[model samples]
Target: MSETSWITTPVTADILRGALELERTEHGVLPHRLPAWARAQSPDGQLAMAEAQPSGVRLVFRTRATAVELDTLRTRPAYPGIPPRADGVYDLLVDGRLFGRATGTGGNVLVLDTAAGTAETRPGPVGTVRFGGLPARVKDVEIWLPYNEITELVALRSNAPVESVPPGDRRVWVHHGSSISHGSNAASATTTWPALAASLGGAELVNLGLGGSALLDQFTARTIRGTAADLISLELGINLVNSDVMRLRAFTPAVHGFLDTIREGHPTTPLLVVSPLLCPIHEDTPGPGAADLSTGTLQFRATGDPAERAAGKLTLRVIRAELARIVEQRAADDPNLHHLDGRVLYGDADFAELPLPDGLHPDAATHERIGERFAKLAFGAGGPFAPR
Candidate 1:
């Protein structure tokens, strides 16, 4: 098709969903999971990179166009010696059904070295991903962006004019967690555990799954507090253990403060506190997780001695117990609050059957399993998020 034959539409906030803020850049609009105020408080590189990836962000519009194309500039992270990661995928949904998938050709690369704690960006040209041959009818079309890569929406072109779709009445689910909830190793944006659960449970998802940065930060709590959500979930423990940023002494009060802040805005909202999924490396061991690159593949191992727990070092086991206790104590008067053991979603048995490929992060199949289990446990009848 000729370039001039397509109708170019501006990517505006009204047609976008799932992002906390929209950033206008020189290239185009960038979706940010963290608000500007939150990002400014902590200049941590890891948090900045993770928030820019747009795990659950997507474009929702109503159109009769059979052919659609999206122009985007993506920045994918690459390690020094390890193999380059796969290009991010763009998923097309027609009337809420997965219709097609495509990947951009080229854009930019951020070469990062965790050992050295350094990163360098190499610029490249924008790439176009096209989807053709849609059924001829006015329908709600959603383009789910890559959950892992930093993407800037440059231009959107369709054969026919696209109109913004009004928000639906689905319950809004606001979720915050580590890389697992951030869609790590998931196949695509819509296939992430949270996304899958939202689909099955009939809810709208606002994913606050920032990789390596879910450290019970106050800014994060404030952001979640301000967002409008019918259901709220905070996945804790793994990131705390992996980062070794706190001891048992600090973790206890931090959890309370985080929850306290959220409750200020959502006093009666259905809030569920979830601990880490079963990770043997950090189950009883503390972290400052070490990356094992000796085998030519990326793997993580806990470095802190298990004995340190006696001295107040935090571990997955310790955090889970503390979280349950805190929630139980708070639930006495807060009937709307609840707690769920993450192991219920992915426990030891599940781990033996489907081992984490990298000693962390669930594979695509496990993402599905966790999603289904979450839907059943949290959104099922008598569950925390079950229909009122």
Candidate 2:
């Protein structure tokens, strides 16, 4: 009971490595990308990260409501076609003991029940639930999903102590983007491009990827103003285009408003403004798809004969051009500010290389490609984002 005997060191990699191990399971928990955890389920399968070291911190998956279909993956094309829907209970276990359960149309809610400790749950399409107060030290974690379902589990992350690396060794990267950046179609928790980019760049990530929520709001910009980051990237345009969210007139001012707020706190930090990658659907076209708000479906149709281009539905080209202009104008006074064409990460040329299954976001392999490009371009040894 002596205080000296109770002293504990912070979480470290070595400590975590010695604490937990992942026993691969046929079922994995997918990353939740959309809002309210509703209408956000991707056709792609989910990727779950497992703990190699528990370090007294463990999170495991149990039963899932939707059948865990491995072939049905998001963020990329549906190779062999997307897997069929799953309907059943998938259970998660820790050391063979039930820790949580996911039940819903697409494995919506995860329920965790434990003692003493505190657990935090993030909302999903179904709902979110967490449990605390468990055996601090867990040895094994397991996932049980619908029968015949296989899951691709990504690297596990634990709340365990972090390694005692020097402050300089730790780099913080702040990124702002739409649903895609929020992980709309990525594989799992760690497979998102931002997550992958963070790992490749050796930087801690502050993902400001709000679903249907990245409207360049002043509130969002103000939020970034108060946060600290060593590197930052803003991926704009596509969401605005796809959603047919704004017109040229509104877009220009919104962009300025968003950047001005960030400038308030980060006058010199390296900033990169990225344009949207290519999407033929909205390249230079314009049209309001069958927006059956009643059913929440957007059936795109080519309604703008030839007059639309003459009129403008705010195509991607226009958006990209405006973004370039914004960055260029801002850069005249801010040397730390830079611009990267989102196409550089994934452009029309690469479309054939890695087509989106849903014809929107990049797939897992593409995510990796984009991550690598981001690291090399933004955080490479001699890149503009290198620590100064």
Candidate 3:
């Protein structure tokens, strides 16, 4: 904790990775998951706020320090008439392995009240998260911020000087999906399913999983198209179904267009089209998903009529069937394209083991299951992500 040997370095966006944008603030840098152009297209304040909050973003550098400290300003949620949400967790990784974890004691906390359906920002004292004791050899360190909180990077101090770490030889996997993929209810930033799968598959990650905003927007596709990635995977269908954004008539073409946009930049990149996982609530039923609060807890439920599927209303089952057919038809011309039924990742069997606690989002245990399953199926031998 002594400052005699410590070096106080500015935690600028230069050392940040996995973020699309770093918005400079008077206090410090705010890592944004989405680019500015994408933000400009949407006027919704909620989506705007979520995109700016760092989820997959992390601080990566080479250092010999056994002790490290980072000051941050975090905003958390407080659901009215229900238990408050858990504070964000910070994870520290060294040499590509998890080394330490810490939670902030104080920070600028924002109370997002669900009953009022509004967010209120409250200014608070900045908090310091510190870690001490490590092997003294030079190694890479990553400080992963929480997935569901707005965090501002204030400062980084270490007992020894640090330098930028060179990129690894592994391929980078860029995945796009909805809140589930955005690490909703995930235990920590690095433990999210995508992160776990990346670690297991020996790949770098750039997660574009925007919570509640993965509406197959053209801007997101453009963002992905602009990124340099060795592989690409689109976890489609869930967001489409739940949002009730489009019918089967529009869905097929939308999927094709989205893929077409990505392929414009990465023609031969392995593209895996993932369908929706089994959620009995929306398996056969159409959705305009609704939140149930009769029990004083937030539980999601499908509000759409099941009979509408005959009229092209999309449901999980309907979308899965359509996506499978689309992939099969497209793969004839594009051999690298593939489709995966998300049920294999979290099917009826998984539900029996660990059910979605919120009736929509997966719990922490389910995240682990999905991550491990994805690594085996997506990156294993004969898999699209497998090393050639």
Candidate 4:
């Protein structure tokens, strides 16, 4: 498809309109905001875009560094002239073609002027600019970011006309997760494990893999609960582990709450909750938390201190076990709920083969491995995510 041909808004615009909800959540909206162009082509554009009106499916991509040092290095290796800024450069594609791109002048700096409510771009090491006003005309789109320059993609949006779409058997898969699921360190949006998995499984997708933003909040879960999807997966626990954001006592209930909210509307839909893959530091460790004395950022740290490690602080192994237990207990009453070990997607053995560059998030090869495993274990015939 031509990059510009992606403007098939008339067809996709309506499909998006039909799924909008009036209720709101921390993340806001049932359908969320249908891009103006996507809404303009529909019959109920006014309602679709009006107050409390549901909009389009939202795909958030977030990042949370397993190693605090990595978090400290965000957007570092500052491009020539740009004063290292968190924002990075990227390209967007739909299907197999280029759709749009975030422009970056190699030697430019981006200044975030919150007071002015606008960012100023000037010559520096690297510059970042967003590309919006997308067509929202198709069920699938691809996002490409400079792998060497940009470490991750934050989110994705679907503006397809959900309201007027011709009747068909197409089922949309709404996925939400952190940087790993968000296409971090991947060559392009299409190459992201989730995107690849969705394509390989033959399901349309709304990517909500927000980099550093998948904290399993009511808002995020509520957002997913209100949206429509045939399949939904929440790759929780990893971010929690890496961020050391909550204690063990709080982790279990948070997972339960997040899932409970999603279950409200998708009562019988296959819902998979995945625990974090193996990351040695948090695999069996605990935490009281460690402050990066250098930056005063309290990153998730494992107290190599044996006494502290034994205290049952929040750890990946602990979180994973707790999640499994919760799912097992809940599944007795909720048959649609399922649990999968993130290791099945990227295990310790797999890590030996393709160690994460930053010792936290998986590298490109690992992403490919994850995509394949997810496709087979989840999308294969008889699997929970398989089409009915």
Ranking by TM-score: 1, 3, 4, 2
Residue 331 of model 3 has an lDDT of 97
Predicted candidate 3 versus true structure: per-residue lDDT over 1-388, tens digit per residue: 3445779888766678889888888778888877889888888766776776677889999888899989888776555666777878899998888988988767665676655668777788788899888678888899998888788888889999988877869898999987888899889999899999998999988988888777778888888999999989988877787889899999889888988999999999999989888898999888888888898888989999999999999998988999999999999999999999999999998899898888999999899989999999999998889998
Better of 1 and 3 by lDDT: 1
Candidate lDDT (C-alpha), each: 0.94, 0.53, 0.86, 0.56
Query: How well does candidate 2 score on lDDT at residue 380?
Result: 85
Model 1 lDDT-worst window of ten? 1-10
Deviation in Å, model 4, residue 372 alpha carbon: 1.2
| Clashing residue pair totals per candidate (backbone < 3 A) | 0, 34, 0, 41
Please report the candidate that would top lDDT against the real structure.
1
In the order shown, what is each candidate's alpha-carbon RMSD?
1.1, 13.0, 1.7, 11.6
For model 4, the superposed segments whose C-alpha errors exceed 4 Å read: 1-168, 287-306, 309-312
Per residue, candidate 1 scores C-alpha lDDT tens digits across 1-388 of 4435899999999989999999999999999999999999998989999999999999999988989999999999998878887788899999999999998878899999887889999999999999988888899999999999999999999988899988879999999999999999999989999999999999999999999999999999999999999999999999999999999999999999999999999999999999989999999989989888899898999999999999999999899999999999999999999999999999989999999999988999999999999999999999999999
Considering only N, C-alpha and C atoms within 3 Å, which residue pairs clash in candidate 1?
none
User: What is the alpha-carbon lDDT of model 3 when measured against the actual structure?
Assistant: 0.86
Q: Score residue 206 of candidate 4 by CA lDDT.
A: 65
Following a full C-alpha superposition, what root-mean-square deviation does model 4 have from the true structure?
11.6
Q: After superposition, how far is residue 317 of candidate 3 from its true place, in Å?
A: 0.5
Model 2 scores a TM of: 0.59
